[model samples]
Target: MSPTQNIVLITGANQGIGYAVAEQLLKHENYFILLGSRNAENGIKAAAKLDPSGKSVEPITIDVTDDASIQQAADQIASKYGHIDVLINNAGNNNEFTHYWKQQESKEEIKLDLAALRQIYREAYDVNLFGAAITTEAFIPLLKKANAKPARIVFVSSHTGSIGLRTDPSSEFYERMSRPSFPAYRSSKTAMNMLTLHYAAMFKEQGWKVNASCPNLTKSAFTRFSDLGRSPAESAVNIVRLANLPENGETGQYLDENGIVAW
Candidate 1:
């Protein structure tokens, strides 16, 4: 790897949006991409598939929900590159989709099973909220060592987490398909948005950029690869754009493909 090349690490990159982002970055000669997957075997396969030449991409085992796994990945990166120019917290879970569906089917008449709801919330938050937080904290030191002008941290979030859109009666999200569902996933992303703001504020003085983005219903395994949403490659455009932002680019904001999204 060239000493001047930028190092980027992306979690949950074996497939979906993460995979798409890696593919897009591979076109840039100055980028050394770290494809992070929860399973070591899967990561290796993804790296090989993404880079048959074995020159630009390297697989890294990083299970966002596990601290030990995150630490190990961070240690390995620090040992090799000493710093990371970009960290994409893209791994997320919507485990409570079924429970939320059940709740919506109740038509506001029946109370949800408390135990089941708790389990769903816990699992969703574990990956979407706590996991992202842990991963970001673990990589802060390496990010500070970036050779680039200003290191960046991007969080892959959703519009369902947008309080403005959720509350605005005139908004499509509030008008159509407004049935209560995915509470855990939605709330977790909301928390993540707030977390992004805090991190941006914390690092502003240090010239580190931290921001969150909504991919706008991408068709991937997360959506069972549904045709209703945009393709993963299409959705990755904004994410890759953010990752490649200039040193003076905006931070601490929520954005989508069109432009800046409301908090």
Candidate 2:
């Protein structure tokens, strides 16, 4: 790897917005991406497709839910590159419970299966919130070794998680507060926002750029592969933009395609 090349690690990069982010970042010759995925075969296949000559991207197996896997991946990166310029925590979970409290069903006073609801909450929190926190913890040493002045850390979050917008009557997502939907998934991301803030504050003195990015209804597996939403490529625009923040770029801000998402 070139000494000047910036190393970027993007988790859950085998498909969806994460894959698109890798694709977009590859446009810049200065970037060297670690395409992180839980499945080694998937990661290898993705890296091969993204960097056929095996020059820019490396596939690494990293299961955010597994502490050992996270630690192993971090150790590997620390050994290979000594530092990481960017860490994009894109791996997440949104399960059956997320869609259980359907808008139509709520009118019938329908109820979610209590056991399943709790199960999904556990799953969502495990991957979305705890996973990110632990991954960041494992990677702090590598990030501190960064060649760049200020390392960039981005959390792939949802604007629907914003309490500020959820409370505003005029806001597009205000209705979400009335209708019970995605409680497990949304709350996990809401907690992730706080996690982002705390990390930002902790690293503020070192000028680390720790922020959240909302893809905003992107067409990906996360959205059940919706056709109406924007493509993963379009959704990745702001995330890659955040991942590539400059030395003096803004920090602790929640950003989306339009910029400056409400807390």
Candidate 3:
């Protein structure tokens, strides 16, 4: 590996937006991309598809929700690269949507099942909130060893997490976004935004850039692979741009495809 090459690790990179970002990053001559997937087989497949030459891109098994898996991945990266120039926390769960939709059926008047709701919330938070937090924490020491002037950490957030947009009646996302009804997934993302802020603040003095970004309803597995929204490749444009930002670039802001998104 070149000493000047940028080492970037992206979680949940086996498919969808994470995969798209990995593809886009290959255009850069200086990046050595680590394609992280929960399953080792899937990670190998993705890495092979992305780089058949078996150079520049490599697969890393990382299940954010599992502490041992996350630590093992971190250890491997640290041993090989010493530090990571970029960390993209892209793994998330939205299983609550399926559960909620199913409950809506076979009932005259919809009722909330507190027990089921709590379970849903816990599952969503496990991957979206706690997983991302723990993954970032485990990689912090490796990030601090970066050869790059300022290491970067990006949380893949959503507009549904924006309190300002969800509360404003005139906002385009107020009614269109499904967050208001899906408390589990929505609240977990909101918590992710907070985590982004706290990390950005904690690493600001070191010139690290940490921020959150909303892909704006991209068509992916998360959206049932529907064709209603932008393509994963299109959604990755801004994320790739943010990932390549200079050491002096902005941090701790919620951004979309256009620009700053309301928090």
> Model 1: runs farther than 4 Å from truth?
98-112
Task: Give the true-structure RMSD of model 2.
Answer: 2.5
For model 1 the local lDDT of residue 217 reads 84
Residue 235 CA displacement from its true place in model 3, Å: 1.2
Measured with C-alpha atoms, the lDDT of residue 170 in candidate 1 is: 79
Please give, for residues 1-263, the per-residue lDDT of candidate 3 as tens digits: 57777899999999999999999988954888999999999999999999998778999999998999999999998888789999999998988767655666657655658887788888899999999999999999998988887889999999988888887888777787634477778889999999999999999999898989899888888877767878999888878877887977999989987889888
Best by TM-score: 3
Tally clashes: model 1: 0
**TM-scores for every predicted model:** 0.93, 0.93, 0.94
For each of the candidates, give the backbone clash count: 0, 0, 0
Ranking by TM-score: 3, 2, 1
- RMSD values for the candidates in order, in angstroms, are 2.6, 2.5, 1.9
Candidate 2 lDDT by residue in tens digits, 1-263:
67888999999999999999999999954899999999999999999999998888999999999999999999999888899999999998878533653644566755558886688788999999999999999999999998877798999999878888887888776786546667778889999999999999999999999999988887787766767688999989999988888878989999897879788
C-alpha-based local distance difference test score of model 1: 0.88
lDDT of 1 by residue, 67-158 (tens): 99999999999998899999999998976765444566787755558896788788889999999999999999999888887899999998
lDDT, model 3, position 164: 80
Model 2 lDDT at residue 139: 94
